[model samples]
Target: MEQLCDCDYEYDSEDQYTMPEFHQKYKDKLPLLVVVSGGFNGKTVYDEVSTNQVIWFHRVCQQSRVLGRLSNQAVRQYEEFVSIPVHSGHMFNVITSSRNESDPETLEDILTKHKLPVLVRLASEAYDYTLRTVKRYTILLLKTYTETFLQGNCLQDDILLPPPLLLAVSPDISVAIATGYVNKSKDTFHRKLRQISEFVKRNVELKEKEGCKEITLFDKQDSTTGTGNSIPPDLLPSYDEDFMYQDIEPDINWIPPIPPNPGFRPSLPARPPDGLLCQNDTPVDSEMESEKLSHKQSSDVSAGTFNSLTVYDDDESGYNSSAGSVKSYISDMSVEDIQSLLGALNLTKYKKDFRKHLIDGAMLEGLEETILREDFKFKHVEVIRLMKYIREGHMPKQ
Candidate 1:
């Protein structure tokens, strides 16, 4: 017989027992600095910042699967910099967090003062037979161009120097020629990149020559600032004679295209000479008794499983109305679902008619929301909405 103890005991496996967290510095949230560069260095900065942010930001922000791969050093650095407040049971309680700008240990104070989000972009290339080292170096130059541009709050065509150009046409390029990695493949990477720079410069120069003088951050050819574009039309240089790509097109008749397979063609279903689907029996017709029964049984099983999941007993009070409502709302809140919904909305006439009007109106005013102990603090509107809910019916206002 098994012995019974006076006191009750429970055994929790190591996997089941989560480590008791001492303190968290802050509630996790996603940071919103759109970093875009042609190389890995810029990616590194993004990774670093995200790593520092995840512990506090994950709770409040929509962290994606891609952000999960950040290294431990980055996480540790963030935790160290953002000290948790001394609190009962909880460490990084936002309620007790110091908001003083003078706080020596805060992350914001350091980053703002130091100007430390280092933007770096590297280079890369891909190929098997043909030499294409230029791809890698072009990426590197792209990084340099981005950094220089970011020095100002924004950038326009404004004669972008290191834009892509061709080697033969551009003279201003400093071609510190280098061979490709792995195989010292025959290539003109540095020269090609320099050419790209020159090409961009010429485009900008053409724009400047045009009547349009102003530029914006996103002032590409199609979307220039002035009524007319700042960018001038690209004039293709003629060689010895004017020639179209069609004129130099290579002719090939490597293999005569085989006639469409008569047996397995799209118009007909394939069949073996014996006409049996398997070794067991002959092919069954659509209205065959056995086949119909099998299909019906399968459909019934599937419907039963779906009904089991979706249909809940109304009499059971296991889940309250509020809980069910919250669950339903959250179920629809996924990014993919929102994206699909937006796509559908965009296809409607209503979108074309009322989009601008909607943007300008207050009908879209959202609920004031606030991040609680573990929730995110998105904006003032959200904060107000949340406050209303939390305060609702709790007290009588005098």
Candidate 2:
């Protein structure tokens, strides 16, 4: 914990049964900076400070799939520090599940729960690889870089580093660099980050000039502030990336055709079904509605809200409404429903048009490839998968 946070923190361990009392004591001072670990028989709490500490703490809890609770304010604050934009409602649910029991202590405890020395060996190997690529530098310079760029707390320890700060260009190494070491310069960290970023830029350009394709974070043409270079073709389909587009085609026996609708008709429901509120079936014709309902109910199991974790009932197919149930079969799927589907499929590029045009499953079932390509501006791959999703009512086999 000290290594990850780079600060001195007070620790407390209490039985799970006594957590209610502990929480009551701290309830008045809502949003205390602490790491609550739901270990078996007891809970381990760390008095943490700073955004990164909270993130790493939550990350550990998340990795272990333990239950954690954060005040609404803490959740919002953590979102501000995340490099990628997070959905305000679903952030809490993703990082912590409902299982508030049996957590492992220490990153190494969970990281190498079964294997011996895996975490240590992995970190050592990462350091060794950095050493190999950075062989031209002297030991002292390497040490300074390690402490400053790799371990510096200037940036958030995100799953992916944004743009020019993509040190090592490997998510595992980037995370290891973020959480594995510590540097405790509070005020001048940003300035140090700037200097290191500049140094990286110069080194990368020099390597490119020397015809060395060993390591590079950003392209020479794009501005440093702009998006970084496209990932190398060699690393194009990462393990997760490989699976992202998989299972999006229907099974062989479930094949169905989606004929083209003449003029793309918006799929906005004429009115909500009896008992359902307007908010429950809000149209996504505008940006405000799109932002509000697009990914609010993203998960398959539950719909997340600001104050509470609400699971969908057996009868309710989608989000909760004041009426107690939401009708969301594919035939009656709303704009928000399709938008959420796009989000789950990681097809964010089509989110705008899909929502703006009120494209629901009914509309999707009739969308033609030419129309999708020309009018909606969807790629060939996207059109294929989307049609399959509409026809099969689920992600299909690749």
Candidate 3:
């Protein structure tokens, strides 16, 4: 019979029920209440302790932290309440029962929509929302909401949340309204949390003043801005604003500078040794040897410096019988040519006047280079004729 029933039983003589017998029947049942009354009084009954209401709110806050600690300390508790249970426990029942007492519908909505695939998505989204809202509320309550709730503010843990949440929330406040934690919008949940918080503070004050036996809640002005988390001002003398506050919000600072022009080319000075050789002195005599050597060296050095220039090396055969070449070349040359040629040699404005000097140098170098080259051919005849042309302003007989 025992094998057929799949039951094992033990008997207790005095109690009329055996330990194993009673356990087999009732072990799976949820405890009707565990710490239900004290937890409820702390959270709900004393929630409105007038100005002294923070006592109850503080207890509720402590309870919330306790809930978190309880939730985390025993995964069984969180799993069972947040979802269906893998295993059963009496302690989990206590937490869930009280946890649902404050807001039944919201809890119901979560539970009603609960399914495996849907719950996984909800769990992920919930984690994200929880991370964001917790950071915001904590910032407001601890950093900005200057209150003497605790003597030293033991719970004011400096929460350094990630920037991604701040970045994500930034756009939501402008479009959604203040639904901090509960609703999908920006205004509703966040505003409500702060409203409750401030309300609790006021009630705490009234309770302390009135010496009330019961918790008494009161109305409070909405202290929080939809954007800013109702943080307190910075103490610095320079109009110190809150950390969340900014002079220019949503504007990305520190952009890159403009790039330089790629095609631009700045010119350099046309190098020295730009003068022409005189039209007079021709070689054949030993006396002109020194002049020939100096002129040759000068031409070579000039060539070394300039990237490009015209050279005149074989022009010793020009007829100079009519005039002096230097004087004649200067005078016969148009005044416009003189100014354009000479004025271009100015050292300043190196880039602009650069090409002009090269052209002038080209003419002069060509003249000297020509003389040096053709001195053998022209002898005194060609040189003398060219010199005369320069002195008197006429071309020598070719």
Candidate 4:
């Protein structure tokens, strides 16, 4: 009775179909496939294009986005597929052949594993393999950036990702990676985003090039090394060597400096008085003056200075300075300090996530075991240890 969005037909809120009817209607047809005018080859028989080929082509299209423009264009030209402007449910139906089940294993366990043909089984394997490969690349990219940029390692040059291949990395992951080259903060968020956009655009341009060499991420050679693999000399002109230059001898002639005009009058400073009364030279009634001055000083101290000092001391001196002094608190620590704390605690694996979340000194001060376990997904023992460190004031100080 539940409504499902089918890509083939106009969306109707009231329209609903049972599992058997939906499967029978769309089992042979590809998901998100629209029969465009001249989209399919004339000689190609529709029946010959099996569901297995459809699924294979679907995944090829998806993965080809990051592979290169030629591959994507080749797949699109040879296959009739519509990826954009389609319902996710419709696509899921094609791959899984299930009206309700969401997991890919459902196709293997209940659908393809029993009733599906050999080709369908092969298609499922291909889909899983390609998906896994893409995921592996994404993880590798994250790890590389984290190790080089986040873990206090020097990243001397700008990060250069292979064209289109970097497209496999999501924007959020890209932003996190950008943190290596850029500081993560409210002010730099848009700058990072703009930088990521430019990278994508450049990658796209490279992807479109007919002869763009496919360079794996992190495999790029260091240009500073001046190795044989470095960019060709013709690409960059030798400005230093080609620029015209000539040395000229210095002139030895000397000229006399100009003298001030005799008619010009210079301002003179005012003279001091002949005599002045010095404090030490004057005599006073010391005994009486000292007593009056002492009385006035005591009154002023009691009236204002003493009270103000008392208020300031009371406000800040509530805590034992030796026990939990402001200097020993973690609230003023930096990201590097947090990393040092993590190293001291032996929780280095969480450094990337900590940086990505901007978990600074102040956040650590208020971190709860529940937050570490649930939000950060830390293990129980790790959470316990961290909480213990926090409670005992064992965290690294600024």
For candidate 1, lDDT tens digit of each residue in 73-179?
A: 11112211001111112111111111212222222222234332211111112242111321221000000000000110111222223331111101111111012
Better lDDT candidate (1, 2): 2
Instruction: Highest TM-score: give the candidate number.
Output: 4
For each candidate in turn, the TM-score is 0.14, 0.19, 0.12, 0.22
lDDT by residue for model 3 (1-398), tens:
11111111111222221212322333344111000011111222211111101111122010000111101111111111111211111111111221122222232243344321111111111234333332221011111111111110101111211211110011111111111222144465345445545654553332221111111111113222221122123311121333322222111332212222222322533323333232233333443665775676578656642223333222333423322234434433432343343333221222122222212221222344244234223345444443333344333233
- Tens digits of per-residue lDDT, candidate 4, 1-398, equal 22132122122334322222323344344222111111111111211111111110011111111111111111112211111111111121222221223434322243334332111111122244333332221110000000000001111123333422211111111110121112345455446435645654444342121211122211122321011112222322132442211122212242211222212222322322443212223333466765665576478555544312332232344443232433235556655566666766668788755754335465576667776776677999888776655544544344
TM-score of structure candidate 3:
0.12
In angstroms, the error of model 3 at 84 is 36
lDDT tens per residue, model 2, 1-398: 33332333223323211223433343344222332222111010111122223211111110111111111111112211001101111111111111222332332233233321111111111233433432321110000001001111122442212322111111111111121223444345445444545544454322111111122222223211011212223321133333212223212233233322222222333544553324444544666655555445344224423223343343443333222221123545545656667765657677655643335555555566777787777788887777656544446445
Q: Which of the two candidates, 1 or 3, achieves a greater TM-score against the reference? A: 1
Candidate lDDT scores, in order, read 0.21, 0.31, 0.24, 0.30
Q: What's model 2's overall lDDT?
A: 0.31
Model 3, which residues run further than 4 Å from truth?
1-222, 225-267, 271-398
Off by over 4 Å in 1: 1-67, 70-319, 338-377, 384-398
Clashing residue pairs found in predicted model 4 = none
